[model samples]
Target: MIQSIKITLFDERTLSVRFGDIIIMPSAKVLKNAQYIELGSYQYWPVLVPRGIRLYTYEQVPGFLRENPYITDGYRAYLTSRLCIKSLFILSNETVNIWSHLLGFFLFFTLGVYDLLAVLTRLGASREDYVIYSISLFCFQVCMLCSVGYHLFCCHRSEKTSRRWMALDYAGISIGIIGCYVPGVFYAFYCNNNAAEICSSPKQMAVFVDPLRHSCSPPYDIHTFVWFGYCLQYWRQVYLVTVLAMMLAVFFAQIHPHYLTKKWQKLRSVIFCAVAGYGLIPTFHWIWLSGGFSSDIVQVS
Candidate 1:
């Protein structure tokens, strides 16, 4: 015998389904406002699956969520925090964007554990190396988690919640930039004197002033070495302090009401790009100090 089914909703609370010769009914309390769809049948009983979640098109969503016109469909809208978390399992346009960053968080977190337990241990890494690696990886993980949270919760019913997440996402980007700068600057100028030791040793200073020594007297050579070492250390501090200040400025700027609006989109991009591009200043300086592109350090790096 051929099997067929029909569904009827008598009111907001009553639902009935007729499958072949069998009739099924759900109580008002159980069926009130719940959403579901029938999926063929098993033996004589019809299978029902919950589908309370809804997906919207780009134009149908709110203005803030309409950032991408190219993504024409598959948007979750008007959801509460509970529903937002529930939607993580639902397949939608943001599925990849959300999962990718989530996975990245896990990847970085795993790498951090391995670095501390195995990689750094094998390398006989110092306390400074441990601190740097921890900071860089922690920033990466924070960046990933912030991006995931922003994307996952951007469709929240409250605009304020969405904007807050957006601000956090941008701040995470700045932190990630710091993560890159810390290690790059640290290792790039690893041989140079730190703030505590402006003049490491006469032997190291001699290496720095060796070429100039033949061109000058002993006293002049010593003076030049001290001056050059102090200058290098000074610039290092300046670069780090500048980056920290820029990060703080960006964080404070994000507090502005108009910062996250579409009107300031380009300005936002420009700010981030400028912050990232600032790294080039130290990069070129390092190249110059390493004897231009011909030096072994510059060439290998």
Candidate 2:
């Protein structure tokens, strides 16, 4: 028993044991492969191994790679199928995808905080504008964070955990798309004369509008033309439904086997572009209905 318990230190990264003058180096791979060692009649268990030990192939990596088979097929030239926390910092194919979004999230988060304390607090900017801007920024943050988490942990061995992370990643994208619409609609609806009337009561405003501050009674007028609250609400409801439908489509496309094919992969870019193009309809409508258009509005949209 005493002899079996003898420990030996090898190179800086390795630990071993001396059993009857023979040293056996212990490692994660070794422990996983050989659970125990027999010294005479005594069986000794090795210490637990830390995770993030090595990389694997598409086949070797855990969970169903069917969602994105191309990920491991040299499509992501820099990607390595790494596992655990090590995957977070590694230079895998997802390295850029992960870091870009992570950095973007932090950037937006810092800007959001500054905007609240500086612009909104000082009463220099419209509170409604600030609220709408903040919502967009927050949505971008959620999207980026979700992308980072998905890229980092998608390589996990547990299929269940990986699947949930993937779902969250898709949901974040949906929310972010909706966020992009927030400021656009806000500015369009409240442009010109209606801008001052944005502080309408909650019931008078569109459901999506925050009702941050109550300023004037409805019969909200933009560009000297009167627009009833119900009319505005009807359009807002349509916009909300459209956004929800797009998000559901994105989510279902990711999960459905039919849409997981290589052909669908090529079509995905077109789908995203089409969705983006659809957003332009509102911008054009705003310009037409307001009877005026400006480069500023174009840039915001």
Candidate 3:
């Protein structure tokens, strides 16, 4: 009697897992709703378990991980990982979220490098040492970088940890979104004190771009004022305002409530969906602003 794994579709996109013995597959609307069907001697089966999402035949999946499906062992790992990731971000727990954000921090670091090198070529930076000023952009990038990392790693934390990490994660998102527009705002409006500021600068600076693949400079005719510290100071203000706004929205809604059991799962889903949809506004703004409705530059994603 050789033992083998049994996997059956439980819904349109889920699986009920059994080691052996029983065969039960019902068309249930609620996937992962915890309905187990056992048959045969029901004792013939070595051990029965529920898999999730993708049903992987033991032979198909990697041997080391084949034992763990979306449910069962895999589910626990997923839960732990998921919880930790969310938690770390809220509390600012400083593991995966922080670590992941750190990765983004480095990316902007490189972008600054490019900006600095480019400045060196063009007669060694104007007043305010625009080359070093690239650090401001880097700073904003850092915020986004941290936010992203938090999102990934916060899943590993305990409940308390998850709450704090999620808050921090929200803060990080606020920071990132605000940061995204800082460089443009600073460079665009630094000079013309008389007129309401605009972010045409990012587009303007883009003109300087040559080795386009590597160039990080903004395009169009951007001109920062000599008094503005090359626009670094302005972005700091942006960060403060953005963080505040993000905190209010995230907390006020009680988005990450206590006890994320099956009950609140759907609520979480809705919140996430809403947040994601809201995020598209800026994204769409960026593409629209960048392309300016230029059919050539824009493509539907």
Better of 1 and 2 by TM-score: 1
Better of 1 and 3 by TM-score: 1
Give RMSD (Å) of candidate 1 vs. truth: 6.1
User: Which segments of candidate 3 are over 4 A away from where they belong?
Assistant: 1-105, 117-123, 127-136, 192-301
Candidate 3, poorest ten consecutive residues by summed lDDT: 39-48
Error of 3 at 105 (Å): 4.1
For model 2, the superposed segments whose C-alpha errors exceed 4 Å read 1-52, 66-83, 191-277, 291-301
Task: Provide the TM-score for each candidate, comma-separated.
Answer: 0.74, 0.54, 0.34
For 1-301, candidate 2 gives per-residue lDDT tens digits of 4467575434223457777767777676764543121122233333333432333345444446445655552111122345455555544556688889889988999989998888677867876667678778877888898888887777666655666677678657766887788766665555334433553544544432433212223322433323434344556556756765776677666555444456677666766676667788776766655334543333454
Compute the lDDT of residue 34 as modeled in candidate 1.
Answer: 56
Model 3 lDDT tens row, 1-301:
5377666644434555564676555356444443232222222212222332222232333333333343222111123554433333332223444566566677777777776777555776565447226535644674565466445543332545445555555545544544444444434323333222233344533442223312222333323322232343454455435534653564445435542456766765775465445545444544544444453334432
- TM-score of predicted structure 1: 0.74
As for TM-score, the candidate ahead, 2 or 3, is 2
Best model number under TM-score: 1
Give per-residue lDDT, candidate 3, residue 107: 73
